[model samples]
Target: MQVNINGIETRYVLSNEGGGPWLTFIHQLGGDLSVWDQLAGYFRNDYTVLRYDLRGHGKTALSREAFGMADLSHDLASLLDALGAPTTHVVGMSMGGMIAQQFALDHPSRVDTLTLANTFGGTRPESRALWEQRAASVREGGMASLVPSTMDRWLTPDFQHAHPEAVEPIREVFGHTLSEGYAMACEAVRDFDVRSKLGTIRCPTLTVAGRHDTGTPPADTQAIADAIEGARFELLDAAHLAPIEQSHRFAALLETFLERPV
Candidate 1:
């Protein structure tokens, strides 16, 4: 459940069912591995599902020195090495999607398929100030300050009213996030940009966008698919966290993509 990867105490779980190729899930910023609970459970039947907390979130420890997206990718690389997993199909949402792109570009050989959901090809210029403001606000008021806004952004109003239970876990994860870790990760995301380098990704890729997701618009997600040689883009009728809002549809889409990529 916990292992030291590149000196960071990373928390991760690998399912033993089927003993098939690994299907790894990476969560978004301010959240932990649990964000992929339903998705992981769905895929565990056929693929060896892996759900892990990023370096600065959940039970994982952050680095003392400065770091970047590449360092996070290195952490993932070391994690697979520790687990003795040769290759994995990576599915990432929001910030996790950025990490997947970085991993695919940096360590191409280790990734079998890349599925980026509700993510961006690069950090937009306007997003820098927003991220900085959030980092400052959380550092000052703690993680609770951002919960309301995050929930509103992640889920549409209709879904929140219809299914409060589904949103509770995400709220808990984001609210309980360590301020230091969240701020540290904020910097990583603030400085991340791989738009120009997206062409380097050689693995079969899938890009997903939430139709109502304002954080990463559908056009942005489509651009990512366009940049990659043969990536496909799909749009879902949900907000930022489409997988949770429409778990069955997302799972079915992913199942098809992994079974027979085009």
Candidate 2:
């Protein structure tokens, strides 16, 4: 479905009718709501799962002006408000994690719990450079230049070898993504830095990382966990997109986190 939130048309997919608490899933760069497909079914029996494409990606409309992390954060807050979910357990990965952090910081009262997976707080210089380079490439050649490297960064060798079927959907999603939207999101990541404000997040937090994740390694996840007070950190034996690489374990971990009393 689509909704006009804060003047921009945002596209989202919702699974309602569950009796449990609300859970919102935010995908990383080069991803849409469908990125959460594997993980969403696991929570269908319990939580109301909401997934959406950030502006400039997937089915959402793109902004002509350059966007920052705050803009993406507000987009999410608006989506939640439109859905009548004032507060929810928010889960985000990679770039989505950055948005989730900002959302929690900006709207503390609207976030029940925070889960960040395979993400960073922007403490590394090299990672920032890499993101900038990616932005430059996308602006020059569009999403095609990003496909191969993105696949390498996101998938584990074993999973890629065992499940070739998984590659096509991601490829198609990338093929159809608006270059403008994808480039703008990359800029948001390049300019994003939330390390100094991590202390401001008051919601219960969980940080999950893939032990084999090269894009955003375990140390990046540790940095986020260390900054957030009493945040629980766990490492799964998967790659960057752990939720897709190890769906069963990832879903169980998320379920357990959401079920825990805050």
Candidate 3:
């Protein structure tokens, strides 16, 4: 289904199983709602699962006007309001994780729990430079030039070799991403600086790190977990795309966290 959120046409899917509260899945940079297909299907039988394409990816089209992470968070807020979801368990990875953090910060009462996977809270100088360079490359050479490097960073060589079929779709998603949209999304990450404000997050939080994820290392994820009061942290034996590479394991972890006593 689709809805107009903050003047942008947002595409989303909601699975109602009539059992539990809403669980919303947010994907990584250059990723669409489809990235959460496996995870959402895993939990759909027990929970109402929601997955939506971010502002500039998948079926969603980007506006010519400038927007930032906060704007993305507002879009989410509008989406939840449209769905009449009072509160939800938000699960996010990579850039989506950053958005989840911003969402929780901006709309504290709307988030029941926050699950961050293979993501960062803020940008370091080196990482900022790296993202800026990537944005430049995308603008100059287009998505094709970035696909090879993105695939290398997103999936380990062993996984890529063993799961070529699994990797192809993601590769195509990255390859087909609009350059303007990709560049703007990169700027959001490049300018994001929320490390100091993480302590203000009042929601129950689960921070996950992929052992082989070089894009957002364990140290970065660990810092986020440390900053949030009583946040749980775990490390999975996968690369950047842990939910895809280790679907069962990731689903199990989320189930255990979300189902635990409050």
Candidate 4:
């Protein structure tokens, strides 16, 4: 389904449509709502699951103006209002994690629980330069140019070799991503810096890190957990895209967390 949000047409899917709490899933850079297919499928039978494509990515209308995290957060908040979802359990991965952090900060009343996976709170100067370079590259060569390196960064070599079928979907998603959207998201990531404000997050939070994820690294995720009071942190045996690379385990962890008392 599609909804007019913040003057952009946002594409989203709301599963298990019955009345109840909602589990909102946010995708990483170069990802669409379909990126949450496996996880959403796992949870929809037992809980309400909502997934959407951020502006400029997937089927969502691209924005002509450059956007930042604040814009993305407003987009999400507006979507929830449009759907009349009073409050939601938010789960975000990678770039989505950064946006989730901002959303929870901006609209604390609407967020029931916060789950951040395989994402960083901030980027170092060196990493910011890398982000800039990658953004420029995508703008010049399109999403295809980053696929080879991104695939390596996202999944383990063994997983890539053993589960070619699993990797193809991710590749297709990347291939379909709009270069302008990807580039703008990269800029948002480059400027991401919330380390000082993480302590203010009052919701129940879970931080999940991939043991083998080199992009964000365990340290980066740990810092996020450390900053958030009472936030639980766990490490998964996968790479960046743990929810995809180790879907069952990731789903189990998330399910258990969601079921915990408030």
Candidate 5:
């Protein structure tokens, strides 16, 4: 469950049922590997699903020093090597997407395909203060205080009202998140900028966007698709956490795209 990787103890779950190409899933800022549990089960019959907690979230240890996207990306790479996986398909959402892009860019040969969903290549310059504000909020009120506003941003009101139970995991996981880890990661997400380098990623890529997601709007996701040659973009009828809100549809799209392209 935990491996000493890149000088940090990384917590991960590797699905046992599937033995095909490794399909690594990364969670958003506040979430851990469980963020992908639903999709991992869906793909476990065919693909080896590897999901893990980022250094500061879940049971994984926090970074020893101030970190960057590259540091986070390398954590994924090293974990795969430790697991003896030579290459893998990388799927990342939100903050995880930034790390995935960094992984694909920094270690192109190791990435079989890239799936960026409900994420952006970078935060706008004007949003720097906003990121700091979030960091402050978490530092002051902890994750519990962020649940309501975050839920509003992640899930639409209708979905929250219709299926309140579904969003509870996020609340629970997020509530328990380490403030230091959250703040460290928030700063990383805040200062992250990979837009100029998105063009360098040559792997088969798919970008998914939540049409109603204001956090990372359709335009932002489309820019990533536009930058990456031959990358495909799909718009889903959900909010920021599209995969959780529209799990079946997102899974169907991912399944179709990942089918051996021969």
Candidate 6:
């Protein structure tokens, strides 16, 4: 379904399931709501799962210029308000994780629990350099140039070799992405630094890390877990897209976490 959030037309798929708390899935950079398809079924039976394209992604309209993390967080807040979701358990991956952090900081009362997967709390020099390279490449060659590199980070060699079906959809997503939207997201990541403020997050938190992830290493997850008092940390033997590559384990962990008493 579509809703106007802060003047931008946002497209979201809301699961009609009732009786459980609402769960929101936020995808990584260059990704849309479809990225969560692999794990959505696991939650659909119990919870109201809301998956939507971030601003400037999928069917969501972009702003006139580039955006910051705060803007993205506000968009999320607007989405929750429009949906009349009093509170939600937010799960975010990579760049989405950064936005989730900011969202929790900005709208504490609206968030029930927070999960950060394959994400970073701040911009490290190495990551900054990589983002710069990707930004440059996207500007010059468009989104196609991002495919091979992104694929390498997203999936393990064995999984890639075994699942040929996954490649085409990923390629389609990459090919159809707007360079400007991606570049703007990269700039948001470049400027993001919330290390000092992570302690402000009061919601119960979980941090999931992909052991083989080069984009946001296990150390990043550890940092997030440590920063948030009593946050649970789990490491999966998968690449960056752990939710896709290890859907069962991811779903199980999330189910266990969300089902726990507050």
Best candidate according to TM-score = 1
For every model shown, the clashing-pair count is 0, 0, 0, 0, 0, 0
Q: Per-residue alpha-carbon lDDT of model 3 for 200-251, expressed as tens digits?
A: 9988999888899988889899999999999988898888988788888888
Question: Model 6 over residues 1-262: C-alpha lDDT tens digits?
Answer: 8999888899999885665789999998988898888677778878889999987788888767778899999999889888889899999999999999999999999899999999989997656777777777898899987798889988899889998797668667767777877888888899888999999888999999999999888998889999998899999999998878888898888888998813
Runs in model 6 deviating more than 4 A are 125-129
Off by over 4 Å in 4: none
Model 2 Cα lDDT, one tens digit per residue, 116-224 = 9999987366567777777788889988877887887888778888888886787779778988888788888888888999988878999999988998989988889
- Clash pairs of candidate 1? none
| Estimated TM-score for each candidate | 0.97, 0.95, 0.97, 0.97, 0.97, 0.95
TM-score pick, better of 1 and 6: 1
Q: Return the clash pairs for model 2, or none.
A: none
Predicted structure 1: lDDT: 0.90
Worst 10 residues of 2 by lDDT: 122-131
Give candidate 3's total backbone clashes: 0
lDDT-better candidate, 2 vs 6: 6
The parts of candidate 3 lying over 4 Å away from their true place are none
Cα lDDT, all candidates? 0.90, 0.86, 0.89, 0.90, 0.90, 0.87
Q: Whose TM-score is higher: candidate 3's or candidate 6's?
A: 3
How many clashing residue pairs, candidate 6?
0
Q: What is the lDDT of residue 1 in candidate 2?
A: 95
Q: Candidate 1: list runs displaced more than 4 Å.
A: none
Could you give the C-alpha RMSD of every candidate to the true structure, in order shown?
A: 1.0, 1.4, 1.2, 1.2, 1.2, 1.5
